[model samples]
Target: METNGTELRISGVLGRLEAVLERENSLIGTDARFDITASNAQKSRCLYELNLLMKSMEPSDLPRAAGDRLIRLRSVVETNATRVKAHMEAVRDVTDLINEAVQAAEADGTYSMDTFRPAAQ
Candidate 1:
C-alpha cells in the first residue's frame, strides 16, 4: 500500500507523543521532578503538527490499517490524559493539606491568650 507524506508525518508525531507520555508516566510513578515546561512544549508542537496533517488529510484517504492504528493511539492518549489529571489532583490535595497543617500550627502557637498573663481588673 502507498503512504502519503501527511500520513507519515502524523504517524511520526503520534509516536513522539506516545514516547513523551510514557516518560511522564514513569516520572509520576517515581515521584521524580521533571521539566514539565519543556515536555509540554514538545507535546504542543507534536499536536500542532498532527492538527495540520489531519487538516490536509481526507477521511477517505486514510487506509483501513492506519485508521485502526489511530484509534489505538487515541485510546492511549486518553488514558495518559486521565492519569495526568489524577496526578495533578493528588498534588493539589497534598498542597492543601500542608497549608491546613501550617495554619493549625500557627493558631496553636505558644503566644496564644492561654499562655499570656492578664492584669487585675
Candidate 2:
C-alpha cells in the first residue's frame, strides 16, 4: 500500500514523541544533572503537534504502521509516567524532610514550661 502524506506526517510526529519520551525516561533515574524543563517542553510540543494531526484524521484512516507506532508510543509513555511519579515522590520526600528540619530548628522552645505546668484550680 502506498503511504500518503498524512501517514508520513503521523509517523514523523509519533517518532518525535517516542524519542522525547525515551530520552526523558533515560534521564529520570540518572545521577547526572539534566534540564528536565527543556525535556518536558519538547515532549509537550511533540504531543501538541501530534494531537493536532490526529484531530484532522479519522481512526479508520490511520495507516497500519501508524497504529503500531501508537502502540509503541503508549508503552513508552506509560513507562515515563511511572518513572516521573517515582521521581516526584522522591522530591516530595526530600522536601518534607527539609521542612521538618527547618521547623525543628526554628522552634525556640520558649513555652516548654507550659506543657509541664498544671492548670490552676
Candidate 3:
C-alpha cells in the first residue's frame, strides 16, 4: 500500500498523542508533583489536527496499520483516563479531610451539652 501524505500526518499525530498520554499515565500516581496542563494541551492539539485530517477522508479509506494504531492508542487513552480518575478522587478525599479539619477547629462549642448543663452543687 502506498502511504500518502495524509496517512503520514495521521500516523505522526497518533504517535504524538500516544506519547503524551503515556507520559501522563506515568506521572499520574507518582509521589513527585507533576502538572498535566502541558500534556493536556498537547493532546488537545493533536486530537484537533487528527480530527481535521480524518474529516477529509472516509473510514474505509483509512490504512490498516493506521486503524491498528488507533486501537492501541485507544487502550492507552483508556488507561490514562482511569489513572486520572483515581488521582482526582484522591485529591478530593484530601480536600474533604482538610475541610473537615478546618470546620472542626473553627467550632466554638457554644451549643454543647456542657453549656446547657446545671451548675455543679
**Superposition error at 100 for model 2 (Å):** 0.6
lDDT of 1: 0.75
RMSD to the true structure for each prediction, in A, is 4.5, 6.0, 5.9
- Model 3 TM-score relative to the real fold: 0.82
Residues 10-84, model 3: lDDT tens digits: 899999999999999988779456787777899899999999988878899998888999998888999999998
Expressed as tens digits, the lDDT of each residue in 37-116 for candidate 2 is 88899988988988987787778878989998888788898999999999989989999999987777557665466666
Give the worst 10-residue stretch by lDDT in candidate 1. 1-10
Which portions of model 2 show Cα errors greater than 4 Å? 1-3, 108-121
Model 1, 68: alpha-carbon shift in Å? 2.2
Off by over 4 Å in 1: 1-3, 110-121
Local distance difference test, each candidate: 0.75, 0.84, 0.87
Error of 3 at 44 (Å): 0.9
